[model samples]
Target: MTIGKRLFNYALIYKKTIIFALLMLMVAVAADLAGPFIAKRMIDQHILGIDSYPWYETDEGENAVLYQDTWYKREDHFSVDDVKGKEVRVLQVGRDYVFVDQPVTTPEGERTYEDGTLTITRSNEEMSYPAVELTNDELLSFYMPEVDDLFKLILVYFALLVVASIFTYGQKFFLETSANRIIKKMRNDVFTHIQKLPIKYFDSLPAGKIVSRITNDTETIKELFVTVLATFVTSIIYITGIYIALFLLDVKLALICLVLVPILVVWIKFYRKYASKYNHIIRSRLSDINAMINESIQGMTIIQAFRRKSETKEEFEEINKDYFDNQNKLLRLNSLTSHNLVGVLRNIAFVALIWYFGGQSLTANSAISLGVLYAFVDYLNRLFQPITGLVNQLANLEQALVSSERVFELLDKDGTEVCEDKMPRYKGNVTFDKVSFGYKEGETVLHDISFEAKEGDTIALVGHTGSGKSSVMNLLSRFYDTKEGKILIDGQDINTIPVQMLRQHMAIVLQDPFLFTGTIASNVSLNDPMITREQVEKALQDVGADRLLKNLQNGYDEKVIEKGSTLSTGQRQLISFARALAFDPAVLILDEATANVDTETEKIIQDGLEVLKKGRTTFIIAHRLSTIKNANQILVLDRGRIVEQGNHDDLMQMRGKYYQMYQLQQGKQSSLAG
Candidate 1:
């Protein structure tokens, strides 16, 4: 799918909520801008320390008569010595100097200053005075505002903060909810695509590897949505507004600090490329390592019996070493992006600051206030922050692109089965006409194999291992289609039917029966939520597996471990038979159905086969010729073509390949008895 289309699909379900989240994010950006502006105003107006003193107006230019006071120093030299006899109290002393036990509060009124006296301050509530005597200038000129103005500024700043918090927190909650919803929908889409993917995909790709792409890779992309998109957008707005404010204050200072920004962007671009490369290498190798570990563990029994433990361990160590090496490369790239870039960018800004501040324009001509210089520095720091996310997000974006390519590639391909327009139902009849197949290109495992088995016919396909018996089954199931001919069900070619429909119409019992991990009822019913417990019990009875089920502690509720590992092979095979029967298919095929069974299971299989074969086309594939003696038609295959064909008595009278195999088995049994 196209990126825009996929994004629309992810958000279309909750479009209204997502729109609200986007609006909140914009508000958050605007609110974040206010914080620095508020701080700069606070410094310029409330903390304007030196500018609080009195000034007398001076006229210099023609038509100009106004000037503003910046600062004034006291001219008083009054000294206070503690009185020896008089009790300390708040009392006026002869209009010269006031004396008291505690420091005196200059009340809100005019106060005089001379060259050599210290003005000690106390509670302004103590007394009142003329506005001029309270400070070196009128009360309006001081850094601390009058009561009314303080309250006004407080109310405005508080409102700004409250709005900022609402935007910030509300944006976070809704963005996360929307992103999670998008991710959930994406995962479901991936799963649907995986189910529909051709069997060729499962044959070539590792299961855990696909799992990592679906789960881990998708989560990495989610990080971009959850944090990077939001932070980067807000930071950009903050940086732009700060840039504008700085330029208005002093253009030269703003220009000097901005010189390092482009350099940092170039630096980020350089490291992002290296990070993506390392990340890909790490991702691919992790898939390989996961495949190896899974296989080694699953084959542990074979490895131990064959004494290949050390070899397996060495193989794992090699892959493990490669995984860590690639991880280290990613770590180094991450470190470079965060720490090293900060140092270089900061150093360049510092050098530019020195040149700008030390220039003749700044020193002599321009009166750049310290507040403006400080704000410019803050803007300089903000400029490079989002550039860092852009760099790291490039790496994150790479993971998303790679995984998307894989996921969409699978989604784009149709299953091997041809799904034609039909009623999506079937009748019971199977016929293979001159079908030829192979495992790979230019390979013909089965050549010109024609077969006819009508409904209710028991056809036995006899062949040795690796002689295309399984390939025949695979072709009929459309796991791999035949190259030379077509397979028909009833009067219709199978290519005209959907895979699910075809599978629903047939059942397969392999040489090695596989079982899912679940309760006995679940295994029997194949976890079909629509299938009732009664159906499971009936299937178990049909396969003679109900006896074993009843012997278990929970009967139908008995749980099977992974792949039914807790059960014996014969018992597991019986469960597989029950599962196949539960589906109630019209075509039943069994390859070595009872070849590995004991005398007891052999008896059960004989009884179950009679019931299962009724009113169905049954194809039995076996290497043991004795098992097919009673078949309706037995075809003996050598290499990829049938060499002999007859009933049991007719084959024995002919003394052909089937006869020779039957004689050999009988001779071996007789020798062992003697």
Candidate 2:
């Protein structure tokens, strides 16, 4: 599906609120558009109505003005059933009003009054009528009848304005509320999906890039919903309302203004074409910059130790400069297309209006009223406001679309569903039958790897670097699936079981143990309600963590920062060991778990391992030969294949690869001791 359709589906999640907001917006637009029409009415029928011809002499004094000892009412105020009387005229010649005793032909045309004669000059004809210019008091009497009606129109106009204001507020409130809710749900869904993704999926991706998608990209999409969505919807509605008002006033001129619609549509298409490319680059470079920053922070110690700060800054500047350049390009695009373009179009529209109204319409036989011209100018000005708004929002719209694409791409990845169903813990009898595995196609890292460990057996795997020690542990943990062979736990194929259920009975303590920001006890239990405080204390005690942690003021409650940086390597490893034991897994793997600690700490960990190995299958990968001397079975590996298989005494008797490795390690220890 297209990004727009996906975005629309998200909006459907809160359709009711959005629909109500739109309804309010429509009402607000209607109320606001009505102003021009109301002003036109006031201008044509009341303000300038005093110059309308055919005043009738009336005996009724209700709406009649007493002028020159005669009570005369404008033709608009006379009742249909009233008796007919001799016709009289009231005309505006220049700034003065002239009263004619007899009506003149052709009320519209250029008018002049001199020597008690009023002349109406048409294109080729002139007609004259005897006339008298009315004094200020007479003109005031003529306008007195419209005073109360004028005040009423003013009140109505303000009432419409108040209604518009209320509805506008309602629309904005509901629209923004719905927008916030949509973004909240989107962020939640994205974060949840990240949990279900396979561990291998993250092997090639940087943590910073993923963080950018969750935070920076999603923030851009929120602006789409909040600012871009509101602006586009409001601009379109206002433009439509203005067009309708224009057509109602004059169809010919309205059709001329209609030309702007296609022009704007074409302009938007042109803007987006270039804007999309620039925005995509900008967003990608931004992600790169974020990734670099996160990497630098993570490895700051190494960087400072190597004195590579200048080189690191230069590398960061390279990516930052690319991001800055793309931003400048987008800024230039916006400058060219937004208000500057709108100003040019507005000027063109006014030029057309002048040509149509001033050059032709005003001098024609059926000239438009001054009120129509005023309303047209007002509507024309109002029309460009929405256009300018829409143009200004184009950059945001493009940016939002790009960010949405990135977010949606992540959501579209195939992920395993988290199964919440519980299963009975299996007996820790594991078998890897002729397993051949590789991270990529046709590049096997483990070849024909076959092994079995019955329940409560301790199997040790010792190998040099790149000999697939960790790969074996990873396969056993189900972090990656084997394509070439079957991995079984208690005679059941692991592929058939849900991933979450398969790992429920297994745990690992890595060489570099990870700890979250919480108390040492909390990290031990991992906040699992099933792991009681007693269990946490027992697990810590079993793993010898309590002895070391008890020195702290808070004991088990002592705080741990990120990665447990404030704690010693031994403390962190002990906590990791406690965490693994607290879960009470049926199968446990320790991958170089004691390699980084001192001899004393290693001895404490070895004592804890004896307690942790009871009633559970254990696999140990260690380079230290002495660490695995008592294992039930040992597999010595080289170049992704097992070279020798036996216990330490048996392998030493063979005098093969395992024996050679042990002798070499013993020589190194003796030399270091000397």
lDDT at 210, model 2 = 90
For every candidate in turn, the CA RMSD to the true structure comes to 10.3, 1.6
Give the distance in Å from residue 374's predicted Cα in candidate 1 to where it truly belongs. 3.7
Candidate 1, residue 630: lDDT: 81
lDDT of 2 by residue, 1-674 (tens): 99999999999999999999999999999999999898998898888897754787888577788888888888888778876577788899999999999866688888999999999988878989999999998888988988888899999999999999999999999999999999999999999999999888899889999999999999999999998999899999999999999999989889998989999999999999999999999999999999999999999999999999999999999999999999999999998888888898899888888888876555747688888888999999999999999999999999999999999999998899999999998999999999989988888999999989999999999988999999999998888999799999999999999989988999999999999999999999999999999999999998898777878998999998888999999999999999999998999999998899999999999998898889999999987989999999999889899889989999999999889899999999999999
Q: For every model in order, what is the number of clashing pairs?
A: 21, 0
lDDT of each: 0.67, 0.91
Q: Candidate 2, which ten residues in sequence have the lowest lDDT sum?
A: 357-366
Model 2, residue 414: C-alpha shift (Å): 1.4
Return the top candidate by lDDT.
2
List where candidate 2 sits over 4 angstroms from the true fold. 360-363
For model 1 the TM-score comes to 0.81
Q: How accurate is candidate 2 locally (lDDT)?
A: 0.91
